[model samples]
Target: MDTRHFTFALRHHMVADTLLLEFHGELDAWADLELAPRVAALLRRRRRAVLVDLRSVTFLDAGGLRLLLRISERSPRRKGRVRLVLDSPQILRVLRITGVDGVFTVLGELPVPFAADDTPDDTDVPA
Candidate 1:
């Protein structure tokens, strides 16, 4: 049997009091592990809000969905808000099917200020 491990990329941005995290590639078990600590640290800062951009995500599984929910729950404790941005129909279906679509604040695009970038192809990703 062949085993395959998937990886994802995360780009962090701050728009005033809002912390934006843009995710690309597959968000699975491995991604959940990699993202937990980074996200936890951000949550601890108690930002006014956090926006997770899933527009570029190619795949999302149950673990990924759970991670989003977990973030949402944790943010409010720190007096912060969490929102998700999704553009793919297939990804939307996953949320809808899981009955979590209504549970989150979902958007189509990155809200202003955060959308103004000098380089269209540039990704301000972390190492």
Candidate 2:
């Protein structure tokens, strides 16, 4: 399980070629700032699949939602894609209320055999 702890609120590990992020605390403005640099770097990498697990999150706010939406913006048609793994009622309710649940490819569990390609191409990833 190769992983890097981004902060108290976010921790990420790699499975196969997919990067999985697990949230432990509030992913508000603070976590958004802390995670931006890393996410920017990943976006620069072409075809890097990202998976976010939010089942552990107790709270969901706009700032956090923005971050998730940003990550999900990666083109799903290519190998560079983002999927959300969440089952929290609180989080689901927030997504539903915000009408964002339909915006993402939500999954109940992590996928097996992830898709990862290290070759990255610049894509105007905002930092």
lDDT of 1 by residue, 72-97 (tens): 87674443347788899999999999
The whole-model C-alpha lDDT of candidate 1 against the native structure comes to: 0.75
Tell me the lDDT of model 2 at 26.
70
How many clashes in candidate 1? 0
| Candidate 1 ranges beyond 4 A from true positions | 1-6, 77-81, 117-127
The TM-score, computed over Cα atoms with residue i paired to residue i, of candidate 2 is 0.70
How high is the lDDT of residue 2 in model 1?
23
> Candidate 2 residues 6-112, lDDT tens each?
33355555666566666666767766776766765665655457777787677778878888887787534466346788878788889989998887778886565
What TM-score does structure 1 among the candidates reach?
0.82
- Total clashing pairs for each candidate: 0, 1
Worst 10 residues of 2 by lDDT: 118-127
